[model samples]
Target: MKKLSVIIVNYNVCHFLEQALTSLAKAAKHVDVEVFVVDNNSVDGSVEMVNEKFPWVKLIANKHNQGFSKANNQAIRESNAEYILLLNPDTVVEEDTLSKCCQFMDEHPDAGGLGVKMLDGKGKFLPESKRGLPSPWVAFYKIFGFAKLFPKSRKFGRYHLGFLSPDEINPIDVLSGAYMMLRSSVLDKIGLLDEDYFMYGEDIDLSYRILKSGHKNYYYPETRIIHYKGESTKRTSINYVFIFYKAMIIFAQKHFSTKNAGIFAVLINTAIYLRAGMALMTGFVQQTWLFFTDAFVMYAGMYVLVNFWERHIKSDSDFYPPEYLHYIVPVYVLVWGLTVFMYGGYKPLAKFYHILAGIVIGTFVIAAFSNFFDAYRFSKGIIVFGGMLSILALLLVRAVVQFIQHGNVKIGDGRKKRVAIIGSYEESKRIDELLKDTHYKLNVLGYITSNKNDVTQKGYLGYLEELEKLVQLYRLDEIIFCSKDVPAHRIIEWMTRVDNRAVDFKIVPDESNFIIGSNSSNKRGDFYSLNIELNILS
Candidate 1:
């Protein structure tokens, strides 16, 4: 048995850390492993909890947050294991995950790094875990939205498809950092993660370095891990977008050609500006409304809400200070409203880190200006602290409201969508296990066999002929057809039968042409004709 050292870096995500450790503890029962947790000065009592609950694991508590790369490096340096697993604190592992990974690496001596399939907390497979290295063309196409037009194009979407198959072990250019299993030999040859990356892009940098050193990066889909992902940064006031962009710049400077780097920089700046512009517009509208309400209504509506809260909870009357009632609250709201608009806060689907970063940057700007102008007669520390506190509270309140409105707000819901996959038994079983282990937003109702009874022994809902009745009976929302062993016409027929019904129909793109043309959008013309132009051929 090989000794595997799992290095987990924590930054204010105690709950996620606990779950990860619990999973690791269960996994450790079947393998020889040592877990080392590098705490990046989390104020969330992560260190204390770990010390009390998991004393068997080694814990290194730092004074301040040193980012992911540095913390993992700290653990790697201290550990004396043959394999270093850079595991995220937000991930959970199955009992045999580490053992299987180790065995795979041992068998493939040329592999520098091995990454298993990573499912999000919802059980949905994360595409990032299997990706090709960033090329100038791929980067440009993706940034420009051209890739979206031809998502199936191999040349255009090579990076995302590098790990499409769940059964086959394949060579990949880059593996996700969430659960990367690095060989000590490769680390010795190529070196540890690039510390310049404060948060993002470090894994890509390291994986590329390993490849450059003539070692292969393998995506082993035989094993699986569940990554809760972004819990801490999503909940905090960190400037993720800036930090990520800074890391991207570092990566571009190191690896990309001057021309490529220039293009990347331009694209990144454009994205930032576009985001900032939207945020500014939204903030302007919101501030205008606030100003009118504050000026005309004498803040009556605001007082009503506050009074309601106070009446219900008598002790929380100090929630909104009367001092903020004059002009302070309005000014704060106006600045951040504009700041958030400028930073792309209105794009709810944007990365949480980016949004949080916007908040942090906005708060800093307000604090800095107030300090310089001597606007308020208060200590700089108190003013800055209070502003941060207020921003956090406001953001939290907004998040709660949004959650209530959406009804999709579950901290650890991991809601799995019940799905009945129509494919071969072998393939379906593999897909079934993959889906079961994933933290994606899907649940496998079970696998349904084809007309041939290939999966009769494996237990299925029914044959393909009875799929419609099963769909109606089970009330399935989605149907996925794996096309490798199944006929395309059968899938089309099945889709046609389910067409216009409440269920969403999707097919696994296996044909080369279909894969190449996956993301292409069709349009209406004077006389409709098929357009077959490849977007990435440009």
Candidate 2:
């Protein structure tokens, strides 16, 4: 038995980290393995939890957030094991997942790294776990709507294939970082992951390097792991888009020819700017009416109302100086615009309260400095009052616009499609729970069970034979067959029986144990059901 060192890098993902460790503990029971958890300055009590619950595992706690590559390298350098598994903190392993992966690698001498099938938390196959290395042309095609135009064509939609058979092991150019099992020798030859990448694309870069060194990367679907993907950074405030693009630039610079690298660099930069432009445009259009209203209110109130009132009604008073008000209002508006721009306040669709708070802080700072320089000549109270009023007016206009647009529809309105699940009570209940927890847009109309053991307390409309009657009665938009208790073929037959009807259909993908390839074709007919046959494998 070859010893395996499992290295999991943690960065404030305590909940997922604990589940991963627990899963690994169960999986490693029959294998010789050492777990190394490199904590990247996680303030979420992950270090303390690991220390308390998994004391036997070696823990390297870092003082700062040393990213994925550096943290994994730290563990890899410290271990003497023949194989290294770079596992994510958001993944759980089956009891035999590691052992099977190790066995496959041991048998395949030319393999540098092996990746297993990764299922999402909902048990759906994640296609990116197995993929081809993205070339510049492929990137362009994917980005420019070519892939969506011809989804089934290999020339266009070759990147994402979900329906591949899960029983076969195949070679691939790139493997996902979620559950990459690397040979220790390959790491020694290619060196550790490029630290230039703080997080994303390091996996692909390393896999490409291994392939360049005459070693193959394998996607072994026989072994599987549950990856709660993106659980760590999904809600983080960090700019991952910027980070990923930066990594791509670093990779291109390191590996590609000078000319090619420069072209890709320009292309990626242009793409980023274009996207930013789109975001700005979207914001502009969304706020155009409101912006105009607020501007008109401010300018008209100051120039027309104030100037007219001060000039005609109180002409003899110094308190109503027309020239002073004219210069002061324009200067104030200019200063406010500059301050907002400098503080990144114009970033359209910025909804965070912190950003608004920053604008307030910027306004106050400007007002304080301007007042101090004037030697109390300008009224500090007036500046503060004016700034507050401006911000309040802007925010109020935005609030009214948002209310008008978003408030038109009620919460839980039928705009989101209503789905009716038909299957055993247990399976339907489980699906309902998942839908409820994830806030999935589907509405469950309850289950239809045939077996006495499948009777559940959650809810039940009828039996499996009553699917047609229920569909007509509930006016369901979609039917999801949970194939846990009943055979999938039977459900398919049932669907065929009602194929001519207007109802849309989908399956739970629990039974049949079939991983549908990306190129699988589905045909529906009066006497036949959803027939899916895999035709291509890449």
Candidate 3:
């Protein structure tokens, strides 16, 4: 029998799944590790990717979107290995991670399952590397924001066990499903992950059951993986809030006493509404802040224009009625705001001409919209003068905002990214050629390597040892590593050593067209490649 069986449940994240499989194939060379890609009906051609690039992997293509737990269980039932590992598709395990996990589990018979110290895409430590079981009080602290208020407080921040050191190997209450390793024997006794959970709480439920079965879960920090997700779920969505809290309630009712379960349910339900309200508020604020800001600025400009026109053009301090400010001017601003929005004025990198066109269309719309209402009608001359003033006001607002944000009043400079590659001459040339056909406007700053023969090649900045300094000197925006030439550990080390947040790191698998990386822990994984049968490239 194999020493370990690795199971990954993939949804529509095809590129991420491919990266994970490539890393796993490398990591499994010394160990008897069998990998299973349980694709949950991904229409993004994820199954085809595994079949084409990684024929050694056992593929389980589901007919529909099976939840994370059931899909993992499907693989678990088929594997005959001593250890079973449930891994996420959007992760890259270091070369030694798999071997280290097997060695640790073999040495610690009391450990039912173990999780590694996880880093985000940018090499920051993920707090979920070790988690405390979410009891009612723990859930309360996390749900109401007390955990964030006192992240290190033992009493309040027990949700993540902030008091425990992430580097130390301590017994932990829960294991993250992203990199959970379990002994096959213990799973046989305690049973598979509860299918009651579609996504969120299965890890906690299994951790609790394992403890109840008298085995321990551990935090192994000797090796780490890039989870890329910081987390996979969109926790800010109301649907996620409801589903996650609902899973918590399920755990409570399944494990707690009837009375305790009732209390836990109440707390979770209350938290659901609170979190949902916050989600709505956050979404509203994020989506409309620019709209509201521009609308207010637009209205203020109209107000100033009306005053100027009344005093100078009409020769009357109060030439227009109260409807001019309350009704007519507001209607005018409203039409302009809608039209400007429709013209893509709110988008980043929208040109000055874009806003000008929007204003023109808006003025025409106001003229037509007012003609049907006699109280708001005016001569074409007056309307044209007001329209001209609106154009100046709107352009000034856009320019000032752009200048403050980008430090340039150029409005929309669509700057090309400064990028570099680390690989052999042939691989670098292949990558450069592929990027030419794509929309990524990048100035490839040449390749970086320690090989002396390629030192004289075009775009050779310097040796790999001088990468950080080279990035600083050249103001490099991104670095792409060809996995065929650079090891995963080296890639991770350089990613950590390079402290420039302005610089992003991407990896192009050997001979693979897609370039994958996540800019930060808070951001989702990114992909750049030709648009194929896959649903989306980014």
Candidate 4:
């Protein structure tokens, strides 16, 4: 009989799945383990790669995605192994991982499920390796930031067992599904993973059931594995946030005492809405600030440059009337600002080319309107000169705004804030190479690897788990993520984890033709593109 059956539910993450299978090959070397990969209709040729390379793996190719719980249950029903491991496809296991789990299970008869210390693509430890039942109090503490502020305190850190050392073996309330190993006996007693949970909270439900069925869930951290977490879903997407919190509500409704469950449901929903509100508020403030700053710069540019051209360049021209400043100048400023706004100029990171184009369009529109009147027709040169000066003024204001806000300027390399890129090795390297000619207020410190064996010796900063440490060590001011490698959901989780830190977070979309603020489709041609979005949390 096989000692263990490892089940991995794979989606569109073909690269990560392939790497995981390679690591699993080493893990099963000394242990009698059968691997099952349940493909969820991935269009990325994941099925073909698995069939070609890892033919020994039991492939359960589903025409449609069966989700996390259902997929694991499908493999569990077919396997004859004494232990079943619900492993994530985006993970790398140590050679001894399977053996250690088997040994731990053999020694602990009362333990129904177990989990190991898991590290992220970066070699830093993931705290979710061991978690407590998210009761109402624990949820409250976590949502309010008390958990992170006082992780070691028993009162505040109940959710993640922050009082316990991650290396120590202990009875934990919850084992993360990423590397959860369950005894067959426990499954017989508690039944399969709850099919109701399509994705999130199923692990917690299973763990709670194990404890209820007279078995303890243990955190055996003697062995460590790397879990490239959040591959199945984009962590930063609004959909992810909604589903995650909604899962908590479902869990609470199922397990908590009636009175407490209702309270927890309310608290969780409130948190969800509060978070959404905060995000919207942040975006609004950022856009409003940029809009006003650009307007002020445009007004100043028209006032100074037009007068200089009239007095110095064309000395015969009468000095421009003061009424132009009050009536005509504001009209130009209003038109320019509105056009720029429509062209996507007031984004988290304003694009220079978009701003320039908007100003040009506004200038032409204003010039055409002035042609209707003979008196205003003569003032066309002023508008032309003002537009030129506005471009320069906008650039200067942007530089000044960046310097005042972040203590960094694009021209002065020494004054610019240091930054690091986090994503797949190739993607990070590509961005680093592309950013060579362009100038910004951030200095590319180097790249951090999001997966194993994907980094140059000098370029390696660390992994995602060690992001905060890397930020502190290098004194980095910003971190850019390649959206293709690190999903939005993972990015959101990372941002939440590093809350209160003074660092900007940005994403580079997968499409090579992506641009920050170009409205027309024609603007996204072969030109190089990059956008450094200001972190809303920051």
Best by TM-score: 3
TM-score of each: 0.55, 0.57, 0.94, 0.70
Q: Give the TM-score of candidate 4.
A: 0.70
State each model's CA lDDT, in order: 0.66, 0.66, 0.85, 0.77
Predicted candidate 4 versus true structure: per-residue lDDT over 263-332, tens digit per residue? 9999899888887777677667765876788788888878777678778877845676667777888888
- lDDT tens digits by residue: candidate 1, 188-287: 9888888888888999899999999999999898767656556546411225545665676778889999998887777766655655566567667764
List, residue by residue over 282-393, the lDDT tens digit for candidate 3. 8899877877777787778777877887788888987888777887777777777787789988886778777778889988887787779886675565567666776777
The regions of model 2 sitting more than 4 angstroms off are 158-168, 235-238, 277-538
Clashes of each: 26, 5, 0, 7
Candidate number of the best lDDT: 3
Task: Enumerate residue pairs that collide in model 4.
Answer: 122-463, 234-489, 235-488, 235-489, 235-490, 236-488, 236-489
Encode model 2's per-residue lDDT on 435-530: one tens digit a residue.
Answer: 564433456667767664554455776666767777778777666666455443354356545643346554454422121111111111010012
Displacement of residue 372 (Cα, Å) in model 2 is 32
Residue pairs with colliding backbones in model 2 are 163-515, 163-516, 163-517, 164-516, 164-517
**Inter-residue clash pairs, candidate 3:** none
